[model samples]
Target: MKKNSLILSVLLVGITACSTVTIKPEGQNKLVNKPTYQDSKPFYLWGLSGEHRVDVLKVCNKNEPLQMQSQQTFSDGVLALITLGIYAPHTVKVWCPKEES
Candidate 1:
């Protein structure tokens, strides 16, 4: 029905609007094609009480990351929405420099 369509449309818009991406530049011309590591960070109380810390050195095997990205993906947004903002999560990605030849 029209009501169902409207609800779906609103949800789609909300999920798309919630996505956010932040990239940190490390002065590298090229980065690895794939992420060195990817994981979801969990937070409680609408992200007010949990720590968002990623051990880049550990993740990159002691190498510096060429770039780092944190994003609120569609799945992340859905999880938060399901929890009614009580639980929030973010996806983090890191790209390491290519191994020296």
Candidate 2:
């Protein structure tokens, strides 16, 4: 019983620690229903350290990012919970337009 409560509390904290957002550029007449380019990587050590490979031109095949969407996964949440905020990971997704020639 006590363990369950502790785990639940840990999970909540882990999830709340991460940031998530979905936003589009303003004043752009064109609107995309979904993100054509996306990327995700693991954040470690309470997000103090992680590998981020979301380079717009190289990875997303775009000149600049137009919008971004991000969310934390359940497995990541569980891992963070078990680790008690020592090992929380996060994922990020990006949307961008093609590079101008």
Candidate 3:
């Protein structure tokens, strides 16, 4: 009984340890009351192996984000996996030229 309880506790800790969230463009802020969403490009998240913690900073570091795809997860005693779909790649680079502009 004690061993089972110990295992369950550990499992619970692992399951909810991470979560997924998405961000959108600044312009989209005016489109609706709630601007943010679980962003996706055109692909689907089938066979989800783990959690997908989202961050917009991901876009800036990489190119325009193939299929605008980004996700993260801790993969079973291994490295945290980051995956993105490459259906469509970015053509032009867009950046905030001015912080206010």
- The positional error of residue 4 in candidate 3, measured at the CA in angstroms, is 0.9
Query: Tens digit of lDDT per residue, candidate 1, span 1-101?
Result: 99999999998667544555546565655443778788999987656778878888888789977778777787787787788778888888888766777
For model 3, give the 10-residue run with minimal summed lDDT.
88-97
TM-scores, one per candidate: 0.71, 0.55, 0.25
Q: Model 2 misses residue 88 by how many Å?
A: 1.7
Candidate 1's C-alpha runs over 4 A off are 1-12, 26-32
Q: By TM-score, how accurate is candidate 2?
A: 0.55
Q: Which pairs clash inside model 1?
A: none
* Span of 10 residues, lowest total lDDT, candidate 2: 30-39
Output the number of the lDDT-best candidate: 1
Candidate 3 Cα lDDT to native = 0.34
Evaluated against the true structure, the overall lDDT of model 2 is 0.66
Best by TM-score: 1
Residue 79 C-alpha lDDT in model 1: 83
**Residue-level lDDT tens digits of model 3 in 1-101:** 99999998887566434333333455543222322233332322332333334443454453332222233333311122123322221111223212232
